[model samples]
Target: MKFGGLQLLLAIALALAAGVLGAIAAGELRDTGQSQTLHHFVHEELDLTDRQKAQLNQLENNFAAERKDMEISLRAANSQLAAAMEDEHEYGPKVVSAIDEVHDRMGDLQKATVRHVFDMRALLDPQQQLRFDRQVASSLTSEPGE
Candidate 1:
């Protein structure tokens, strides 16, 4: 039960495609879940004052712009990874560097997002903060679709 060269190549291609598609799908699902968690907690669960609402709106606008920039950089890093994978055709130095670059970009985005969440938390009153904290913890710990 040895694979021929063409069959091996086809299997490798299918595996790579599956990996890429899974990553994309997982990212989308995570994004959607995070968005819903934040939206429900901030907009519906908490009783926000007008002033707090205004401040949160400003924070959201600023974070939105920053997130967009980070997402663009992440996409560029992903492109570099793809190019490296294509050119190297193996787990080589360029591919390693590209993977590191992508990870760094992703870390940057995650850090910024966490900071933004804290910034929003800072505006909440004590009671609201309690709920917010719980929501954040739940979102972080819960399984998907929970």
Candidate 2:
């Protein structure tokens, strides 16, 4: 039997969810020393002194830790909302309010991430800062057309 539009959308969502779980299971999404983006950016882009590298690395670690905690809390909130929705009688104003709260926290987490990036930028010397800005601009401009 041919699937209707809603059924097709549901199937697509299921597939996407399965793909995400599979990636996590395969260790592709695991945190690793080599997978730290800020560290990689500094190593590849900046000519930092040993002391500078150490300080930057510490900052990167702190940012990653805080971001991870925020992500975990967000996931917990989403799961709570989903569980609430599954209860037909209980899915009311409370569920809607919970979802809104989670959305607000997600927005705050994103803004915090941006602020952390700026903190990283502040760690650079004037010459390195100029180079960093140029590198970021070039990377964005090099992206394929929309």
Candidate 3:
């Protein structure tokens, strides 16, 4: 329950790093070209059959719908926390707790997203799965404007 100074510092540093990474990833996901990139990777790189592509699209749409409300709530909570943080007395702990709750919600969302993607991957052939993995790696490496 207790942490040394070094341990606490390291934990804070890692959390900050994760926050930065998540922000960057969220920005990338918001990109309009990302939709085209996903379609191209699925069609050409993974060589998903027409039916498979359709199924995948349907699955993604369902995920988007399912997560939409939760995402909005999380965003709103985050904004509230940020606003509250400007005040020291009335909202400090409340803002910190709200931020922590939002972080937990985001972590849950990430886990669900990974599970769904893995389920989709399971439907693909081995060669296609390899290609898909490579495509993801390539996408991660090739940042915006590069």
Candidate 4:
């Protein structure tokens, strides 16, 4: 996609998630000294019970499906936008419309990501919820790799 800004935003979001998960995993590894994947980190750090793990797994899977569909639509919109921009002869209303479509897709993706985060956070207990909130806040406010 030509929307480098949008791509960067998404990358940052994923990076933040990874960094936070890694940090949590690091703390958990003090006793065992074994490396932890993000999935294991989440379970250990969040103190997720079996039921919660199943629920979170289901939720993640559901969001992944929805996100895949959204991505396909967004990709189509971006392709149209790129084609319109590449039409050397004329810059018409089609270009404007394509730009709008791309922006709309970006907005939709952003909304979906935020909603997914909130949905996941809702599964946590009071203490874990606070930790989740802090992780998100810190990630959003701080630069990548900070």
* Residue 13, candidate 4: alpha-carbon lDDT: 55
Q: Across residues 11-63, which tens digit of lDDT does each residue of candidate 3 receive?
A: 45544554454454343244554544644667676767888878888888887
The lDDT, on a scale of 0 to 1, for candidate 1 is 0.74
> What is the C-alpha lDDT profile of model 1 across 1-146, one tens digit per residue?
44567655654564455345434422433654344767667988798999999999999999889888887777777777766666666678997897778778777877887898899999999999998998889877887766
TM-score of 1: 0.79
Which lDDT tens digits does candidate 4 get at residues 13-70?
Answer: 5434433433342222232433433345466777898887889999889988987787
lDDT: the better of candidates 1 and 2: 1
Against the reference, the lDDT scores of all candidates come to 0.74, 0.61, 0.63, 0.64
What is the RMSD of candidate 2?
A: 7.5
Please say which candidate is ahead in lDDT: 1 or 3: 1
Candidate whose TM-score is highest? 1
Q: Write the per-residue lDDT of candidate 2 for residues 44-108, one digit (tens) a residue.
A: 76878898888878987997798777767666666555544443234487567656666665666
Scored against the true structure, residue 34 in model 4 reaches a CA lDDT of 32
Kindly report which residue pairs in candidate 4 clash with one another: none
* Cα TM-score per model: 0.79, 0.62, 0.64, 0.68
Tell me how candidate 3 scores on lDDT: 0.63
Q: How many clashing residue pairs appear in each of the predictions shown?
A: 0, 0, 0, 0
lDDT of 4: 0.64
**What C-alpha RMSD separates each model from the true structure?**
5.1, 7.5, 8.8, 10.5
